[model samples]
Target: MITIQYAIIGGTGVYDSGVASIQKTVNTEYGKVEVDIAEVEGTSMVFLARHGKEHGIPPHLINYRANIKALQELGVQHIFATAAVGSLNPDYPTGSLVVLSDFMEMTKQRPLTFFEGGTDDVKHVNMDDPYCGNLRKHLLEAAKLHKIQFKGNAVYLCTEGPRFETEAEIRMMRKWGADVVGMTSVPEVVLAKELGMCYASVGFVVNMATGMESGPIQLESIGDMLARNKEKVNKMFLDIFSKTLDQQNCGCADSIVCL
Candidate 1:
């Protein structure tokens, strides 16, 4: 019965920390998920590999509702999610980091909300500003202090797929003001919001979006880059985790009524 205040849910490979110790596999309404509890500076936090430990779960196949519910049940109040994304903006190249400030959901078919059920009534969660402001600010400050080159802000586009988006889709998203493109982050952000948890996303640029990249997309090479850049990603989280816990209230910490 370990109580954790913060939870990090993202790709499996992103958390290869040798220190992470598996606490237990939490069985939820949706499915069973392995939850790892670790200590950073004596603060206990939970980590869940969004995909299974072996990276078996695809973006569209993620049991988002179950994952969020499991964390909420564990009393987690803040969530930091990471995703490997393709940069729509030329300035944001491979290995670059972006603290997502906003997101556009182009994903469908996946369950997008928690208010639907036989017993649960209809509810709408306000997302005027999706990412948690306080957490984002703290992360930016940490990046500066750590001398980590972090792009201050970004608009992440959430798409549905195991497959990457086509060049035409990327072009359309850029026109719609998207700065980054990825398959995850839609329901993940929205679910955290509905749970009254402060949530923010960190996007690690794996490559330039379709058409922008040289030659064809080589996922293996991108995976290698992400692997090489994992240290920086870990450091960013370490900084964010240490800083954000001290703040009292953020706009993201507040809640609104559904109409």
Candidate 2:
């Protein structure tokens, strides 16, 4: 079982890019993760489908622990994750890309840490800047080079759901300083921090939270937005992954305690 240095956990929009070669499945303490490993621009990269290969899994049910654990086991040095979210701030209209910097978790039941077994020693992980700064820098640079319109310094709010939030719920998220709201960012960010893997999230806004849009909640519009932004998102991921793999000595690989 050889480990790869760069990995991406996303959906079919990314995994099915035909850029990656099919690889073996890895078993983790949490579950088995299927990764397609390949080389891009002379750099080795691995891509995994967060919602399974066919988008079959729901957000609330994603096996975050097993996914992160397996990636760590495979020697992944850094990670790039993409999520579909709803905009909480009116300024950030639907279909916008948000590079998340901070996050707040509103979920109560998912396992959020890796240091909680009776036999496992207690360890405290620092999370002041949860997203990896170096990775974020590379992404920002790549986005610029590609001329992709994006907003940085975003606060992502992780909510418990397979369902969209209500207008009132979205309003509370806005008050809490959240630019975007989604279901999978919490444990994903925290687990990467624990494993010391540099991680960054590229949030794709799929819709305006329920009440904010003129009409009542409509599923078709959200689907339409995702469909439209799919190409840009794919191109952005390819660029960022290629760049990070080239700059192996980025600040992302440094020790957090030294910061």
What TM-score goes with each of the models?
0.92, 0.89
lDDT of 1 by residue, 4-54 (tens): 788887673686755556677788887887888888887778888888778
lDDT of 2 by residue, 148-171 (tens): 778656799998887778888888
Instruction: Judge candidate 2 against the unseen true structure and give its global Cα lDDT, from 0 to 1.
Output: 0.77
Which parts of model 1 have CA positions greater than 4 angstroms off?
117-121, 243-248
- The clash numbers for all candidates, in the given order, read 0, 1
Looking at model 1, residue 185 earns an lDDT score of: 91
Candidate 1, position 1, lDDT: 69
